[model samples]
Target: MSFNPDILDIISLTIGALLFLMVLVLIIVFALEKEYYAVRKSLILLLFPAFFLIMPFLNFPYQDYLLLGISGLISLAFIVLVMPFNNRKKISDYTFSNKVDERDIMFSRIRLEEGTENHNAYYTDRPRNKEIDDAIKANPSLLSEGSTYYNLFQFASANASFDTVEAYHDHLYKDPAPVKKDVDAKQLSGYIKAWSKKLGAVDCGITELKDYHTYSKLGRSHNYGSDCKLDHKYAIAFTVEMNKDMMAAAPAGSTVMESAFQYLNAGSIAMQLAYFLRSLGYESLAHIDGRYEVIAPIVAKDAGLGELGRMGLLMTPKLGSRVRIGVVTTNAPLNIDKATFAPDVIDFCRICKKCADCCPGKAISHSDRKNINGDIRWQIAQEECFRYWTICGTDCGRCMAVCPYSHPNNFLHNFVRKGLRNSYLFRRFALKMDDFLYVRKPAPGSPPQWVKKNS
Candidate 1:
């Protein structure tokens, strides 16, 4: 069929509109970086679209068909050239044999009361921890002014959420009646994912429970004298994204606000999942903030969710460390994804030690991953890290803010993430580029202007 002028005009208008939108997006992204030269270069690229839009109006010697063909080819080339690198390896390749002890986590230890048998047993098993444990005990606790920027109001506000989560702990561990009907694993999995998403989960995955993911002894529960044993067969893990704007204001009221917000989100999802499993005639437990039996990150990692980065937090492909995780352990039979590790994250973290450099307490490790609990991993000094938080009266999330992966979940940041995943060469290049665009030790940014007066 022969192409008509009206048809050509319509095609030109659509392409022009799309091109303009793309340019506008690029401009805004570049503006966020505060880099003038990059913005200028991106603007210069807009010339091609500007010419195309004007060319449609001009009665040049060139045929419309030829012009259309050339424009289409140019657009195709641009897409190919601009496509971000994506080097994601199979989830199986990153799996490690390492097992995690639930007793080693700070939450578990914090749940220990002085002179408790579990606390005594923990120190006996790992005597070296006593000195560090003593150090934490000596500090002005969370919500106390002994912290660096302690704000009683903010700390208490954050604590209120934790209080609500505590109210759900007992309800999670209850057993349900047996179901007469056979349970469909696939259907149940789909229902859980949908419900989790509806409850504000950013991502969800299932994995078989491993010995290392559980604590050796019960540290947090009233059964503090009992040995820790999670006999559950499967674990359901999910993540809730943290707000970039709020987190950027690290060591401030806004940072605490974001932390509490996600904790509540994650907690709610876990509680619902546990309750749902009960309705289905199964026993399950929700491990939300402050209440836990299993380590959520380890389970999430095994479930092919993401890697653990330098800040000792899950670095999901989409949200990085700027997220909170919740887990539900159950006896239900289900398909599970083998734990996957992302070496690119490790490589990037090795070079990009922004968290270590920015930490106010210098608690994050600057050295390589060490042997801890029979696993090769970087160990942050938990006592020092928590002490800093107690002093600051905030979670002291400067590390989360400075992480290159903690950028806003927008197209611009996703483009960079795609590059980091696809090519080793691009991973190295993008790490340096991230440092350039966002400083290696970015200053703690202020909250939105509107929040300042009220805050």
Candidate 2:
């Protein structure tokens, strides 16, 4: 049998390219800090490409055409998988129909002491939550000595971070700016975004402040049940990267430490941004730590930061649910972004329930989106989740840890993300591939060396 020289060159090129990709994938897996995945990817990449290269010599009938057919098929499959076609024209499906009460949130509920006036008033209004809230409170608390995975040093460190964040509560509120400078909204918005990144934020976005973004009432610390009335016209939302190593230790002390630490980082950036805006005479309020008037995720989504996921958290394109968000609600004239339709991510969430499966608290809903607070979205079992956090002496980020989307943000993972966005078939194949390479429930990675040595 004879083949054209051009056809031969094409085959050789395809084989050589795939062989190179195989090595590239191996290096990528290693760079992503995935040992098991590196091994599995290396074998698969090597074997599959080698099969294509050695096909002509396999002594099969019409081996030359068989190789061409196989290579063509592979190319066709790649083309189909990388094509972007989805619900881009549709309106965003996750918009809230109404505002959420700050008091209704678990963090707010946890602050209320039983027998106190606020507690009685709240429990009386929502009798259904009393029993659940009480049960959660009865557990060994978060960052406490009696809880599981309670490392004294780690808890102390996490506590210290939270304490600093709380201390910044007063800093969020500033006196009128003495030097009000005339600033360009577009340039200022650009400056804010760039400066936010300089201050450790991974992403920054702006949105028109909405009634839904603000909490209905005050629920934390002093001034409980007070009206959280703020007429801020614009909001700045940003996300900060949570260390992959720390987050991989999900449902463990390291996860809590990391969460708390990132909260501080986010808070710090928010505080700085707010201060900067206010210095220019804008009425900026940094919503951080335990003092929040805005629903951070909602505000972030509105700001084009990310889409809301099944776990009821912001799933950023880069970090998935592995990042913590911070917000600065202000009267600054910053450019606002429109809500982007991310049905691909939504579709992926519908299929990928790895978070729900791994959730120690069984907090994440496995079922499809339902009418929650009048919006079509997934609702988590808040009381159940808080109870597990209390049990672990940590936030128990197993959902974030096991999430396939929460893989490290790099070329390899980003390429898979792009594929998922582009093709539903690739999304399904990627999920299966994810399971094959990393398994559904990978063991919690060991804590950082500093944590281990100290603990």
Candidate 3:
């Protein structure tokens, strides 16, 4: 083939046009999503066309070879960028040594009345927690009158939702009449999952119960400090979506209201599921917010719902950490789902510390994940977290609100989730984009219309 300058010029113009069009499309996409930083970055990518167009006009010696060399380098870079070489996030190889103690948790400790046997027994065993626990005990309580972000109606609404959850707390356990129904394991499992989703759950799965899933002791109501000895064969886990708009007002009363509301939604689904299973003539127990024998995140993880993220929350594919989890344990025969190990989820969490950065109490760890008991997982400082909740009169969901994974489930965000799930490079790039496109310290949004109106 002869080295014709006209042919080279045509090639250059064609390449430049395609590059320009691609950048334009990207800018439009970002703009439509109201992603200012993404639009800005895409506009900068207009430089991609500079060399292809200007190089053709440059009177360089051996221009054809120069263009070929540039093209080869660009193509190689493109391949490397898009390659799926990142390791799939594997579930931590480490497992918990034993069951967790509910009494040791902040919530359980908070409920301890001062100068009582329950209080003395706990403080005597772990004196270190005494000072801090008491400090939290003195703070303005959650949704209290004088606390930050307290609105008369908002606090009342949250309290009402919590009160409703408390009502269901005592109803978690019940005896089965008899084994009246001889059901196929797979069929029953399918029915339960479908029924859960129909009851407003976003996702549901079943996992064979594990020893580590049970708490070592009860923490709430009259059963405080009693050993939790649940030995169910299977666990049904489900998640309900927390409203994105309401969540945007995190660290405020609206977030607490949303949290409490979702707790009820998830709890209702769980209790109904458990009741249905028991009616089949098998033992079943609902694990709601206040009366949980098993760890919901661990159960959800094993049930294939989602993987645990850096904030010690279940990061579901659709809703990330923005969903509330509920579980039901039963002896009824049912199929179990295999948990997925998306190393990319871990990889993303390793880099994106938005949740940690936004935590008011500095409760979330900013360091590399550590070994807890035996499990290699991120351990959040429960005392600090709950203490902040008491002070703010809210659940202090700043971490959840700022989490990169907790974005609204729309096409633009879901596409990013897919990238985070599929490629390591994309996950790394996505975190950078998230920080750039969203913000390092995003301002909390306003409360919902209902909340505002009531206020």
Candidate 4:
């Protein structure tokens, strides 16, 4: 069909105007989001639409047809990108039968004194780790003054939060009330989930306790090396978000300050949930920091909270890895939430290696997921990560800070997340756009003004 020149001009002008406005809006959005790189990139992008806007006025023959053809190609690309495809498998489709031994975790090894019997026994059992463990221990410890990014006020604040969390350890478990209170499983589950949100949890879910969820041995405290005795039938898992501004300054004092506070926040919420359950004549135990019998990320995954990311942390739908996890296991009868396996998270992680690129410790794996204990997954080098933590005197959150999924949970980002979840082609487009806007490796942000005030 022959196209009318007037109609073609109008359509071309409309497309150009829309493209210009979109780029303009993105510039403003990037500025508001504090992404200077994106703003600059958007400024450059304005030229693209500017050329199209003037295309109609040019003396060149068949210009209208060219513009129409270009618009058609763009529309076709958009449709292809938005179509959902390659949603392969649920996270549970993989098998992981092996139980983790908590005694082998970094935290457990860090607590072992050089001359103590526990240390000697552990070294005897695993002599290969002795040299590396000692080297890591030799570094200036987390929050200690002799390390990078030391700030007296920030470090003290973090320590105080950690100390307060430790205080909740004693209240993790309590005897059921003398008079049993019968409750409806579904109703109680709903109540607990709602109450958890009221107590600062970003999300909460319950799952039937599984054997792989529990640690084979106790890791920390005086009862170290003892067999784990947890026999709870249900596990309630929740997450509390970390402040994006605070965490942006990764490996800095403010980052640890925020991390510590969130740990305490999550722990306090878990303790309250456990206490409330026990009062209702249900036996429950809060799995706080340094006192966990359960593998929290696994429990959180099973509870439908989030999926595991390449950095070996739970990547929540809203907050990504920028959150602290809390768990409370109990014998209380409760309706379990079916774990909604997000193939998008896995698919995105597969293509996006930003975390690995930004990791200061080089701890995160750059390769694809491997068969880890029968389940295909990416595993970070824990020793390398912890060693860097010791050196920095902070849990260097470089990986979390740089993850595209770790962007602030707001309308602008949520819109991107929606597109990310909907289409595999959009995932590739989104990644490129993200890299163009935010850059592949963003520098660590400065701590808040208050964190630097006076000191």
- Two-way lDDT contest, 1 vs 4, winner: 4
Q: Model 2 compared with the native: what TM-score?
A: 0.93
**Shift in Å, residue 45, candidate 2:** 4.0
Candidate 1, residues 1-455, lDDT tens digits: the string is: 55345777767766777787887787788788554445666676577567667665767565587668967896775565456544444222333455445577665676677897777888898898888777776777666677665655566767787777777766766767667246888888888888899889988999988887776655556655466567889999999998877777798877887788788889888988888788878888888776677777778888778988777888899988988899999987677866656777887777788899999988999887766655677768877888687667788789998888987777888987876765666667677666655667877887656556664
lDDT tens digits, residue span 1-455, model 4: 55445766777778889989988888887788777778998898988688777876766877767787888998899788877765665433443478988878899999998888999999999999999998998999999999998889889999999999999877766797877698999999999999999999999999999999998888786679899888889999999999887888897888899999999999999988988988998889999888999999989999998888899999998988988999999988899999877888888998999999999999999898899878888889999999999999998888888899999888778888888889888888999999988889888888877777755
Best by lDDT: 4
lDDT of model 2, residue 324: 97
Cα error, residue 52 of model 4, in Å, equals 3.2
Candidate 3: C-alpha lDDT: 0.84
Q: After superposition, how far is residue 219 of candidate 3 from its true place, in Å?
A: 1.3
Candidate 1 Cα misplacement greater than 4 A, ranges: 1-24, 30-104, 108-127
3 or 4, which is superior by lDDT? Answer: 4
For all predicted structures, in order, the TM-scores are 0.79, 0.93, 0.88, 0.95
Q: What is candidate 2's lDDT per residue for 412-431, written digit by digit as tens?
A: 78988998888778888889
TM-score: model 3 vs. ground truth: 0.88
All models, RMSD in angstroms: 6.6, 2.6, 3.8, 2.7
lDDT of each: 0.76, 0.84, 0.84, 0.88
Clashing pairs in 2: none
Better of 1 and 4 by TM-score: 4
lDDT of 3 by residue, 204-251 (tens): 999999988998888875788788778889999999999877887888
